[model samples]
Target: MNNLRIVVRGGGDLATGVIHRLWRAGFTPLVLECASPAAIRRQVALCEAVYAGSATVEGMTGVLIHSLSEAVAVWQADQVPVLVDETAACVNILQPEIVIDAIIAKKNLGTHIDMAPLTIALGPGFTAGMDVHAVVETKRGHNLGRVILEGSAAPNSGIPGVIAGFGKERVLHAPAAGVLHVVQDIGSVVQKGQLIAEITTADGSVVPVEATLTGIIRGMIRDGFPVTEGFKIADIDPRQEELANCFTISDKARCIAGSVLELVCAYANKA
Candidate 1:
């Protein structure tokens, strides 16, 4: 059990929480991410290591690695490793004890029950006992982190969770397909209607994305990334004074991570 290897799909903020929890519990968790992830909360996302070579969240560091050997080296150093294996080819190579799909892509992007000895998925788009061994609820409600062993989590609501009584109002979406250019960095205080970012279309038409409510720039996509219409690009925290929240894992993320830890422990005990 001390040498258990966990492979996590995605390196976004939510996934990072699970990785952090697993690591603290004495598991070696490696992350798989795309060449360029669209994670808006880059400050807390381990996937940012793919672009920056290394990224730190809270007290943990995630180092970019090119191969399984390098990943093992990172593990020996007591650090998480991020690899460019979006389709999770390493699952077969590493033969990890656990596999977690934390992409939060709102749909099951090919994660199956047989990927590992114990498999778990976060958020919607997965059915317990079918798509994976367990499904952790991600929505902000009564079942936020409830482990579902026989059914699926709630469907995608398309509405962001309410903060300061503002549901969907705290999220910024791209108006059209183009390259995103952010004018404000995360943690910047903003007022309603303030221009935080803009999208440049093919013909050079600029579409401005403004703050829907007065708040702090909690998260925003990296500059120069291509975006499509209606794609989530930023998140504003209505608690204008809570700047530290930007770097720490959210309550929802921590709750879900705890669920994953429980599932892992349960499986290990059963074995």
Candidate 2:
């Protein structure tokens, strides 16, 4: 096994794809996440382990740990370790050769190239060769997952990729800032205008979040999670029959993961 230690910042679905690919390729990867992750696609997100103690995604398991020693132990046991360190406070102690900022927050949140020998960021908020060693395109178009050596990917258009003739209609956003309560779970078929969730504002006013199109719920924020106005709370797959996709990584994610691995390996060889 290649003993390259990699630390992935974020354990969401997209990040999970990278972690899975690294582990299968014989590299040790540890995930860093916040105490409460806001992953809409919980089924394929390893960060869910933070709340469940342990979570399995596509056969690989992620165990939550508090310290570096426990994370190392989990890796020894052949499982991915997820630590609750939003700022990656353990990076100095772990000293991973590679660090990937996969938070997908659409903005740079304190990630820099000096953090590791090879640092990578996904999406447009980071500048390659400056903020990080390189950047992987996350936009869903021609350059999706392409590695950028000295620039950034396209900015987030705030529009979800088109699926089955549905674009923005496939997404559900919170109407008000408050706690979210899901009335329907993922994989459930729903019709347009059907109630999917409710947001209780600080003043106790309830706002209904309805489906914008008829489709299967491919993703949804966890119940009781705090959400901000206009925040994406759910994703509906227009191909209602393809429920299997709800539990597996998307093609976009796999492409990004492969690009990340290739970049990391190329850097390791040069070093």
Candidate 3:
């Protein structure tokens, strides 16, 4: 077997707790987090691997996407320790055989995920330095597992996609070619059918571009640069009311339709 290796996700005090447990037991760790490197510098040396991107652990059947993706890299160590994170509104978007819901509110945020009959694993409330018992329900019956909380809970996270207009505005550009099709400028109020920017070939070729939606211009292509086809011309804010509910974090719901991905793998072994 390889040396003990644990890949934990989260950048809070809760995460630190889990890290501490592993270290106290003489196991190294890897952290898959999105916070700034300087913020978690102390833990950096202790981690054998780090994925500074979002660690999405949607409940998948028999396969955790993020864990599986990092398997090769983390496995390089001795034994693949564990990758785990806690979520209030945990979801099994990947269809995990087990779904865990520890959300505080049971109203709209009910823990009952859409898909059932898999397995449900949950700790009443997971907190730093807290030890708890979890009930695991399978097709046949329930099993018991021990749960210990460490480090910070988790960042109230969200991810939002921007809707942009069609234009040469706010788009990163090539130091190459293109011409304006219409009066397109940064921070302009554009309509759905508005004409944005256009390009002409050196040999008398002309191209026409149209606006994609109605919104305020948010970005621009770099100044004095030529743009190639399919380049980002601008950024726009959608006029839809949904924008009001848009969340820019990850752990939280961007909308009611969204789900939180939390994957944890913890196995007790000897040092």
Model 2 TM-score, all chains together: 0.97
RMSD of each: 1.0, 1.1, 16.5
| Structural similarity to truth (TM-score) of each candidate | 0.98, 0.97, 0.26
Candidate scoring better on TM-score of 1 and 2: 1
Residue 64, model 3: Cα distance from true site in angstroms: 46
What is each predicted model's overall lDDT from 0 to 1? 0.92, 0.92, 0.34
- Please report how far candidate 2 places residue 85 from its true position, in Å: 0.7
Assess candidate 1 and give its lDDT: 0.92
Model 1 bad stretches (over 4 Å)? none
Winner on TM-score between 2 and 3 is 2
**Comparison by TM-score, 1 against 3, better one:** 1
Off by over 4 Å in 3: 1-182, 240-271
Q: Write the per-residue lDDT of candidate 1 for residues 123-155, one digit (tens) a residue.
A: 899999989999999999888999999999999
Tens digit of lDDT per residue, candidate 3, span 161-235?
333332333233322256433346545677776766556646657665555677654434433335555544454
